[model samples]
Target: MSVRVFVVGIGSGDPGHLTGEAVAALNAVDVFLVADKRAATRDLVTLRAELCAAVITHDRYRFVEVPDPERGPDAERDSTAYAGAVRDWHTERARRHAEAVTREVGDDGTVGLLVWGDPSLYDSTLRVVETIGDLLGAEGVTLEVTVVPGISSVSLLAARHRVALNRVGRPVHITTGRRLVGEYDDALGDVVVMLDGDLACAGLVETHPDLEIFWGAQLGLYDEALVRGPLREVLPEIRRRRDAVRAARGWVMDTYLLRPGTGR
Candidate 1:
């Protein structure tokens, strides 16, 4: 018996953010694999409960903490080591997830994984699935896959800030904070950066201090916070707030967008 998989994105941390179809698919899955950075971040579980809205109980819900492959034993906060370590970690996680699927699904069930945001976005759940699929195929296990889309950090950021993704007729660039730091490029339209470890804006500011940045933290939830202004002025406050919230809550998932000075 082969196992099929469905990966659902839970969207930031809000159960309400889940689309109707996503909720239906989530409830129908035979096994739900939840990947949390730490078991402490119960946001996914909580979101499930909230979205279900009727005291739903999943006999097959399995919470798996993948230990964020991005941070390893020497995982420094947002360091290069952290990045590489995560790649290695995800490889391991996919292997373990494959094992879990084999056991629980018994080679004939649908295993579902709830991703934090849109799977097509920065979320690595898809990559994990790919790795696991390859391993399973090598081991002579067949598999099929499906991905349920959910709101992304960028969409949530735009909603929280009450701003449109792009101006009237402008194109938008969506990239990571690291990329922004590495390449000091600007857009004539709008620029949105995600997966930023609090470095993109700062890096942009040293050279283009006047660039306007709209930052949002924990978007779509009650603890949500947002800041907007010139990068130089808002960068420090964003860092402070980002740090303070992470320390206070033990985890954070944020997304921000930087718009070049088009005087709009």
Candidate 2:
């Protein structure tokens, strides 16, 4: 049995972010693997459903809800433990996806996995598909993978702020909140941080008072909010607003860019 998988990037929470290529891919899919992990992120599942409903005109496509793997305390303690936990989690997820593909989709049929933002940026759907292929290949299941790109949160953040991601000919360093704690250096040019549940920018601002920050939460959504100014001046308000928004909505997906400069 041959299975074809389309890892489609649906962009950041907004249906309008879907590209022409993504819409075409949606029409080609027979099954959509939706991840339902936590109550806080249930809205993300709903948004994917809405995207399908809005773009997919055929009734041939169906959704298969997959329970995501849990990343426990191992992900919080250290880098080694965190990497191991993530690897284990992805392996488990690949097993689940392989079963779903073989049972839910017919031979030669195409399956879709709706990824938030572009698959190339901080998303793991492509890696999961590769794992699924490896697992299923032993059972005589051949796999073909296709990636459809969509607007990334990084692009949306820059557009919303009306600023370039880099400074002149300098490079843009993209990293996570945890890494920013120890790896951050002003000499690294402009830095963009994501997956920051801890508000690392608040702490960094204390040391680098001249740094400027452009922060956005729930980018491209109706409740999207952006804050920008000197890190020292805006960090407190960003924290307050982020907390209030998260409390009201149960979750928040935010990204920020930190540059070494004074506020305009």
Candidate 3:
């Protein structure tokens, strides 16, 4: 019998974000592989369990914890170090994930990985699952994977801000916080930035002072925070509010769109 894995996107932070398909997948799961990330992410894991309780009709399913590996302090400071750390971490996670599957579930059992936001985005769960599949192949077992899509933080940001992501006929550039400055261009029209823990736009305050920004933090959560206005005028407020939300909630996820020529 083949192993079944469902990669379900649960959307950003809200149980209400689960679609009908995601709900169905939740019920189908026999075991949910949850990552015990860190102290700051404890709430995140709780949120998943809460989501499952709120959605699934049966209590037969259970969670199996995958002890996540640390990437080291310097991983965030340097690009090369960060890449290396992430690769090593994923390799280790794959091993642990495979071991957990082998020990807990039978070959025909169903596993669910609840991913935050869309799997096709910056998330690595899909890639890690691919590695898990390879490892399971040793026992002549194959994985039958199913993916259920969820709304991304970028989509939630645009919805909350009530703005179109792009201007009339122009394309919007999507990039991470680290690469935004280099990718920022008037030709791109609207640039959507994500995975930016440092508020990288702050660096563009002087150079692109008049640029309009529609920013949202913890999108869809009860305490969601949003900032909109000139990049220079509202940036400090964004940073302050962002820090406050992170302090109160142990973590924060934010995304923004940079528009040229004043508020599109």
Candidate 4:
């Protein structure tokens, strides 16, 4: 019996952030798997509650929490030691989630995973599913998976900040903090950088201090904060506010859009 899994993105902690189609699909999911509930936890519960509040089929949903991959001190290192560690962690994470699906399905059953933002975006839930799918396929557990897209953090950020992602006749590059820090060979007209740890804009201005930045954190939440200016002035404030909030909340979710030189 083949296992049918639906990978659905629930947006950034808000049911209102979800699209109509996404909400419908979420309401239709039989079993829901939420990753990293024990660690970086409450938010997932809140997210689930939000989803339930939006949909009428609350009682039909069965939720499972899958442990997230370890993000430790060595997570950022490029050495063979650290690389191996990260790979092992991801593999283990995938294995556990796959095992859960296998055990739960036992034969033919449908399961759904709630991913933050769009699953096809920077989210790694799909990658985990891919790894686990291959593992299960080899073990004779046939798997079929479908992904339902939600409003991306970038799109939310744009709406919140009232900024266009790309200029009239230009292009925008959407990338991660690591890529922003490493090398930007292409000319950046307008860019929205996500998965950043607040140092992304700083890195850009450390070399050229003339860039403009529009930054925001907790976009759809009450604690949302936005700062826009030259990177030199804005970067420090972003770090300061981000650290304080992180310390207070135990977690933070943020995304920023930046442009070289000038942008409102």
The lDDT of each candidate is 0.73, 0.88, 0.88, 0.75
True lDDT of residue 243, candidate 2: 94
Query: What's model 4's overall lDDT?
Result: 0.75
lDDT of 3 by residue, 1-264 (tens): 588999999997477898999999999999999999898879888888988999899999999889998767741567787788789889899999999998888968999999999999899998899998898888677899999999999889899888889878889889999888766777777999988878888878778777888999888877899999888888889989999999999889889999874544
Give the alpha carbon lDDT tens digit for every residue of 84-162 in model 4: 7767877888899987887665576778887777888887777778899999888988878888888787888888778
CA lDDT, candidate 2, residue 150: 89
Evaluation by lDDT, superior candidate among 1 and 4 = 4
How well does each candidate superpose onto the true structure, as a TM-score? 0.84, 0.97, 0.95, 0.89
Off by over 4 Å in 1: 39-70, 73-86, 262-264
Name the runs in model 2 displaced over 4 angstroms.
none
- In candidate 3, stretches whose alpha carbon ends up further than 4 angstroms from where it belongs are 74-77
List candidate 4 segments past 4 Å from native.
37-40, 74-76, 79-86
Worst 10 residues of 2 by lDDT: 68-77
RMSD (Cα, Å) for all candidates, in order, is 3.2, 1.2, 1.5, 2.4
* Per-candidate total of colliding backbone pairs: 2, 0, 0, 0
Model 4 per-residue lDDT at 211: 74
Comparison by lDDT, 3 against 4, better one:
3
Determine the backbone clash count of candidate 3.
0
Best by TM-score: 2
